[model samples]
Target: MSPSQTLEDESHPSITAVNRRIQRLSLHLTPLPPFQPSPQLHMLECAKAANKLEVDKASLQCYMRGKNRELQEKVINFFESRPDLQTPVGIPMEEHRELCMRQIVALVRDAKIRPFRYVVDDPAKYFAITEAVGSIDVSLGIKVGVQFSLWGGSVLNLGTKKHRDKYFDGIDNVDYPGCFAMTELHHGSNVQGLQTTATFDPITDEFIIDTPNDGAIKWWIGNAAVHGKFATVFAKLILPTHDSKKVSDMGVHAFIVPIRHLKTHQTLPGIEIQDCGHKIGLNGVDNGALRFRSVRIPRDNLLNRFGDVSRDGKYTSSLPTINKRFAAMLGELVGGRVGLAYSSVGFLKISVTIAVRYSLLRQQFGPPQQPEVSILDYQSQQHKLMPMLASTYAFHFAAQYLVEKYSEMKKTHDEQLVADVHALSAGLKSYITSYTAKSLSTCREACGGHGYAAVNRFGSLRNDHDIFQTFEGDNTVLLQQVAADLLKQYKDKFQGGTLSVTWNYLRESMNTYLSQPNPITARWESTDHLRDPKFQLDAFRYRTSRLLQSVAARLRKHSKTLGSFGAWNRCLNHLLTLAESHIESVILARFIEAVQNCPDASSQAALKLVCDLYALDRIWNDIGTYRNVDYVAPNKAKAIHKLTEYLCFQVRNIAGELIDAFDIPESITRAPIAMQSEAYSQYTHHVGFQ
Candidate 1:
């Protein structure tokens, strides 16, 4: 061998050594798993399976529509048949407002739907029409709500017979378009703090409505900008004392103040109306601000069911305290919150239907050489949509229950039931609207780039639904009211006060869940246990009861140093959680009851499945809360997560029937992506590509 070859051989490692090193490295490197082929999911087959799912769509529809299925269909049919009522895209705000007003006019004159007539004679029918209108066009819904629910409701609920007799016909017919001028520039949730004053003028026998400062100007008043001829204006009622000449403030009262001339449609002499201009959404509302220099209405215009001004200008109210009278007046208007909650569910149904329908058609990556899988088949997409679908079902039942309770309260006038309804409405409204708003954004994202298109309806739906969280009642403030009411009930429970029907669970919950959860039950991970209605309800009750006890204790501990309001401020987040927990429990209970009460076995079974998904998904999302308190073992939490996914899969299999049960007409959805067939083709046509 040459010396150079010998050197090279020595410099390099021997072949045996290299082999040994390679063997050692191979030991550390993990081999990729053997490829298992993905099962091909055919879009047509999946769609067929969804349609074949044994769910009683008609029964489910009837259950969801509650009191007025035929009436709702009648109203929806009227709007669907009219091309003029169809929502147009990309219109200027002014044109949209005009369209909305025209749609309302059509409903009254063409359709012969008298909204105010139903206020007393048939409130359920009235609400049914409201829901139907809202499902078609949210802007038109708000206009109708402003004219009928708020303005006309004020007269019906707060006014005496004479006021109703004079205004109901014109208001209902849109001859006297009216605004509900309660919200001010600086004050909204605090209705008691409204700064507009209505001072009684004994000589003129009229009440002078004045906006004292810019802050007192009525803001966000629907119909005020162009159409409102009058307003149900809320202002502090000041009356001269009989003994002294000084005036006394008698809290807030509603007055029917004329805002515009009936003949010329001009602003009244003392009223200044300015368009609120553009908004993030609901531009069809024609929201405007109003300022009164000295707008005057006769004393008889006062909605005097609870408080009144006499001919001599003396203020009298059956309730002695000003606060009590104000409470009573506001209580009469809880229907707005109920209507919002009920209508928000409709928006959620529409959004979920759009997203789910599109998901069923849109295909993406799958097994090679096979047809691409429907996006709805993917686990991630199911996660985004199924829980929301389940929640829509849950809220439907809860909102229906709310309507029933409100209707009963109106008939019976039970004071306890009234308070119960108030608190319940606040909680449901806050929870449902907030959930719908958030879910709309999720729906938008779930549809990928197609969802981003304005023509898809997600953008407008979300934008308009977003304000549902603010108007009626600010969600945060409404939740605080719920917390306050819960605390009151918590104290009353200790004093041996009988709990109302809605809250009777509190007594049992305190007894059963105040202690640590049973080890066997906490660690139970079986599918049957996790899906059990009893087990699910027990878990919800435990969470709410524990939260109530803990929050009360925390507040007591902090109040010594922080004072009452300060203590509450410190525990604000905890209080919100507590309120939400309670509301969720209420919703779950209502859903369970609905399933049991369902007449059709197939529909009941379907509803049961949806209910299970809602309950388990809720618990899974808050598993940390359960884990922190040892209410659920780690293994059980895993089980819940697994069952939740499984339920999502099951629901996905039947998504078609579930959404179809909503029976929303395609014309109302107005999204090319939501088309029953050839969705992509319709989408292309919508975008002007064809």
Candidate 2:
């Protein structure tokens, strides 16, 4: 039964027909022309599709798209104009990198369309522009992310006014392309362990930067292989050798280091650069590694807003503790985490769009008296896909809230607000990216074999997005960061210490439940109770509170015997669960708030159902946890299951419309089976099936 032996003889009739049909399909298949949907067209489609949503279609689309509908179209149109921007199959990796670099330059060169220039002037527009571009091509999205969000952002957030005045204009106009050099080969998530050193030399009034070993080399740097002329390098700032004595480490600080000659595009002396070579996806990005041997930059090159070195080489910082200062410095890059989360959700939308479209057009077995039915009509398939469709909507609103929070945080230097933003960003990035990876895999399976083909785009998307799970921050590690913050809040509340207003509701619930004589269990008489946003939020809060308390008890028990680190390690699993609950609470609250605040009744009603489905689905999945904590009765879990089934069916009818609200460009989807305009007869005729 080996493939070679089997192929030596003529294939069976069914196999022959399948092969012929595939050949015919291949003949008709071609690269899709570039496309970007106009905002008007997007609005019009929503209008036509509103009946399915039980809302004002145009209004819903506008609300769903935020205020960036027009900007999104412009982004699409920009990509459509440059075919080379598309990451075509079979192209040489080197050529792909070059084309991406060229397009990035062109996009940023034009004064009217230049995206980086707005990073400081107008952050909202900058975010919208980056999201739009990212939605089109992740490779392009990441290039922009590295240049503006990372390298340029480091200057905006970490550097002082002096650095801004010197580099802001050049950064916007692509005068000298740069990379964010932070992750070293051995110390990515554990950033504190990075081995690169920048030691101040008083005699020369310069900092001598060196990658002490191979492990300290900056690896996986976007724009590093070739194009970047400079980098914002993060290293342990070693105090200057002074007073005939050794100086201590000053902790991690960012420095503007020139790695390449501006004119020649050649690595400067004492710098070695090498490409990371091929990767699973996102090949167009020129990811590379860098090693420095006594590279020298002037003292002023340090990005010294938070921490500075005096002319006499004394290290000083405004923050009280080195850890606090480092945290503050790293917090400045929270936008990267936020952007990646947004991008993950965007990728999810496209994945679901292609899967839903394919399921609609693809036909399968039916009764003898009837024609074949679309796979979408089958309950099993709907069960797999519709919930993901609903989740896309849920995360969409949550991401919007996160983006707004980020914007507000940028305008002020409020400490508590910064911490809240950090926890939320870290939590959501882990939640959304992990969900996206699973959803994308499911979408690929939903498409059956066709999804495996490169032309369908899922393979590229899945591979490209897979890295996101670990890139900005490892999802598991990020969740720990979230959990650690939540635990602090919980402990503080119990000690009668001040708690942030952000934790007010959760804290109040904890106090109320702890004082109650009996545990609060689900008491809804009917599944109808599941649809109430207040009920759903309350139930979520109850479960989250119980879990938080459980985690607290477990940690306290472990701490008495095992010591701090050991206790944390032993309870890591429960801690992650606790973090997930807190995050889910935030998502539910955001979703409910969004639905309740809608101005249009119809839009509100439609979104209400969408929100219900998202919340109910989550509860249904975690019924075991709910029961474990005595937060829900067995009967209630059963009721949740029934309600979940009903909501899936309810969501199924409007699934297409829900995805359409995402307004993903057809050009971006690029799946042959997703073409609704093509007649089945053409396919049948080509296959000689008629």
lDDT of 1 by residue, 1-20 (tens): 22222122235446655665
- In terms of TM-score, which candidate is strongest? 1
Which model scores highest in lDDT? 1
Give the worst 10-residue stretch by lDDT in candidate 2: 1-10
- In model 1, what is the error at residue 94, expressed in angstroms? 1.3
Screening candidate 1 with a backbone cut-off below 3 angstroms (N, C-alpha, C), the clashing residue pairs are: none
| RMSD (Å) per prediction | 9.7, 13.6
Candidate 2 structure quality by residue, lDDT tens digits, 1-690: 232221213547557657867987987797666797668545543544463556467667777888766876887887788776666765678987887787777676631577776665666677788777776668878898899989999998899999989998888888878999999999999988889999988888999999998899999999999789999999999884644577778889999999898888778999999999999988889999999999999999999988998888787888977798889998889888998888888898889998998898889998698999889867789889988887888898889998888888888867788888899999999999999999989999999987887777788888889999998899999999988988899888878877765566766667665443233345453766668776787777777677678887888899999998889999899889888887888888888898888887877877877788889889888877666545666566788887787667667767766667677767777666665557345434444777
Off by over 4 Å in 1: 1-53, 242-245
lDDT of each: 0.89, 0.81
Candidate 2: global Cα-lDDT?
0.81
